[model samples]
Target: MESQPILATGRLLLRPFTLADAPEVQRLAGDYAVSATTLLPYPYPDGLAEVWIASLREGAERGDAAAFAVTLARGGDLIGGVRLQIDAEHSRGELGFWIAQACWGRGYATEAVGAVIGYGFSALGLHRVHAIHFSRNPASGRVMEKCGMVHEGRLRQHVRKWGVYEDVDLWGIVSPIRAEIPHPLRSMPV
Candidate 1:
């Protein structure tokens, strides 16, 4: 197990969430507009952010997950988050991210996602990484595409958001380390 390293992009810093960020995380993620499209609940229960941030430490210790607080590089304001729920047994990880509604369209999500994907491959030894977005949120899908992920498929009614079922679009990218070595999906016995 290793410490979660900070990931930086030109405009953003992807760092581990500190309890100090709990207030800003609550303010931004609590917004209905931000929670509507993602799984985060509206009203964003009090103290949950702190609890969640604390749990991330335990998860990281187990190699089960890595979560980063997305912030501005210049001003250092916390704006959002990006995380990987790692499946160590399969050598893969599931990515998830969100930016405050006010911060939408700034490319922060795309930048942070690219950095985390790199960390997953280079640091975590992941063979592949994947993400899922509610189909209605094409903007998020676009972010995934901008990061070089391929749209794998759509899972209809795969998730219930705010009580209504929604379709989820699946996207994935293989580690460049693995991509360089060409291989078949199957091996035939001759």
Candidate 2:
């Protein structure tokens, strides 16, 4: 696979991250309020953004990831990011995203997520796309819900974040195309 295509929404542009974006990515994503709710590490270390940005292309080239810099469509200011970690063999992708704390409550997360899911199902031919959020952060779960994901389940003490175990809520949406394919077990005699 080559470079991921740029995605557009009414108020935002989902574009690939560049080396120049390292500073803003560091500034916005490094915030404690933003990092606390998501998987981003607190006291975000120096030069980590550059290293992370540099590493994204390898996954894109392998057709296994699509990491985007979320920006305002009008001014092109970097606001946050969204991604899909693809599992081609299983025809699915794990979705993740974050918005700068200043931009919260404006629906950017919901819009970007919807676009990425559309890309996953249509462009990537994924059968299912899912996301998970720390159970304490219902706002993130709300973003997933607004995108039409169902409350799949919860895992007790599923992830160790910042040295503490945190429960997580799983959410998912299967492609409409999935129903077109027959399940192998559907035809099995009970």
Candidate 3:
């Protein structure tokens, strides 16, 4: 659940995002570098962050998604958010995340994604969990890879941002008990 606070990783904490986190979320995620990687835009407004926080709360209760604010465990500083969308009927889920500019290159994304994926598999009993990111954000691709999701394919010109279309690389992980083996992406040649 989006509003439900979660335990932090050794390096990061995934917390429930309330209306209070709006300002910090906007400040961190509203930057050009941060927003460019995700679907959000630069110069985000005051109320936009509040809306997003509320959306997370609403989504979680409605079972549309489970999202968390990524924070530093020691200082409890907010940086970004990670999401998991559950498809209970199929026993699958989708993973997504965005970290602030200041936290870039610190492996915070990997820590957060790995924790969430573990929650997906162990807690949610999901048969499969997947993710995708813009090709422009190679670092996120690395996060997915490091989190054990294999790069399945690239969807060409699949998403339009600002005025142009962008490509996205799809990635996924699943239970080895199923018909296929769960390949930890660390072995991939990519």
Candidate 4:
């Protein structure tokens, strides 16, 4: 696959990460509130954002994953990120996202997620897009719900984070059928 394509939505834009975004990525993703809910390591480590951004394009090229920087449509300010980890053989992908704590409750996560799911099913030909969130964070689950993903199930102590085990809630959406309907014909007298 080539570089990930830019995805635009009504209120936001989803574009591939660039090295120039590292500083803001670190500033937003480094917060304890952000890192605590995500897989990002705490204290966020120096240069890690740049390193991660640098790896994204190659991963996209290899069909392994695609990560996008979520930004405001009007000002183009980086606010967060969303990613899809692909499973080509199964025609599926796992969706993950994080918005800065300051940007939470603004519907940004839900909007960004919807766009990515659309791209996954329509552009990438994915059959299913799924997501999992730490059970403690119902807000993330709410975002998934708003995007039309159904609650699949929950895994008890499925993830160990910050030296503690956390339950995970799984959610998913399958591509909807788009077959055309046949037009009705006039009936002839028998």
Candidate 5:
């Protein structure tokens, strides 16, 4: 498979991860505020970031997933990461992301996710892209909403996190055609 290309947005750049990014990944993703809200383990172990970055290439090669390092377009500082876990047979992918705690509420997550969702639909020819967040983290859901993703439904106690079952909210956006049509019970747009 061809390598994932760098994606650009108005204020952000989504590019392939590099070994040099390990330090910052460790620093930002290590925080419980970041890790606890996602699947990442708390007290992030040493060298795990490097291991994760290395696996991204392998996953891409196997056509299973693609991960991107989210950075600033101007200064190129690594601030977060986003990923698309592909299910090619179904023409869909699962989206996931995290931003540094310091960058919260700045619209960076929405910008980065929008760029990747565009890539999934336009570049990868995907039919749909979906994401889920722990129910406690509504901010993450807001990012999905801002990217035009509709709230699909909530999975009750669907995931075991930190020894507790956590509810998850699923959100998704289908291709443009699917987005335009109204449901059978709903009136058409004027």
Candidate 6:
């Protein structure tokens, strides 16, 4: 991978998923707000979290496209997660992210995700990077904007969530390696 084994920011460290972080993964994934936007089952159990984390680690080893956890370098605690998954042909990858509600005010997701995108462009040698969010969640749209993705379009009633058909917000950032927008999204101070 062109991206180094790991990436770090002043307050964050983006590294591959590992089974050892299962407990923190449980705490964050188990949160309702995080799960609500993320499509993670609301009552995500500790065991499920363990399995999910284990699977992510395994997937990376198998050459599956995936992401690393966003953790505080100081405490080494999982504050969030960012994933970049490539489709089978390896042409493009999707960017996914989630931050614990408790960490929302801190701009952590923006920084971590941006760093990961840089990794993908430089190291992963990927071309297209995009993200989709349930329409009910506009914060995700903002995150995409913060990351430098242009407004592409909206898919009306594209998915079913909690038993009702729902819409989706689709935004994409393509690094031709020389796009006018030189950087990924960055959170603007509110």
List lDDT for all candidates, in order. Answer: 0.92, 0.93, 0.84, 0.91, 0.92, 0.79
Candidate 5 per-residue C-alpha lDDT over 1-190 given as tens digits, one digit per residue, 9 for 90 to 100: 7889999899988999999999899989898999889998888899999999999999999987989899999999999999999999988999989999999999999999988988888878788999999999999999999999999999999999999999999998998844565667676556
Superposition error at 178 for model 4 (Å): 8.0
TM-score of 5: 0.91
Identify the candidate with maximal TM-score: 2
Mind giving the per-residue lDDT tens digits that candidate 6 earns over 1-190?
A: 2333879998998887777777878877789888877777877775887788767766676655667889899998888899888763744778888998988968788888888777777776677788899988888888788988887898998877678788898998887674555344454554
**Number of backbone clashes in candidate 4:** 0
Error of 3 at 6 (Å): 1.2
Ranking by lDDT: 2, 1, 5, 4, 3, 6
Backbone clashes in model 3, listed as residue pairs: none
Candidate 1 residue-wise lDDT at 32: 91
The runs of at least 3 residues in candidate 1 whose Cα sits more than 4 Å from the true structure, single-residue gaps closed, are: 180-189
lDDT of 2 by residue, 54-123 (tens): 8899889989999999999999999999999999999999998999999999999999999999989988
Residues forming the 10-long window of minimal summed lDDT in candidate 3: 174-183
Cα TM-score per model: 0.94, 0.95, 0.87, 0.92, 0.91, 0.86
| All models, RMSD in angstroms | 1.7, 1.4, 6.4, 6.2, 4.7, 8.0
Stretches of candidate 3 exceeding 4 Å from the true structure: 1-5, 176-190
Question: Which 10-residue window of candidate 5 scores lowest in summed lDDT?
Answer: 177-186
Instruction: List where candidate 5 sits over 4 angstroms from the true fold.
Output: 177-190
Tell me model 2's lDDT, rounded to 2 decimals. 0.93
lDDT of 2 at 87: 93
Task: Please identify which of the two predictions, 1 or 4, would achieve the higher lDDT against the true structure.
Answer: 1
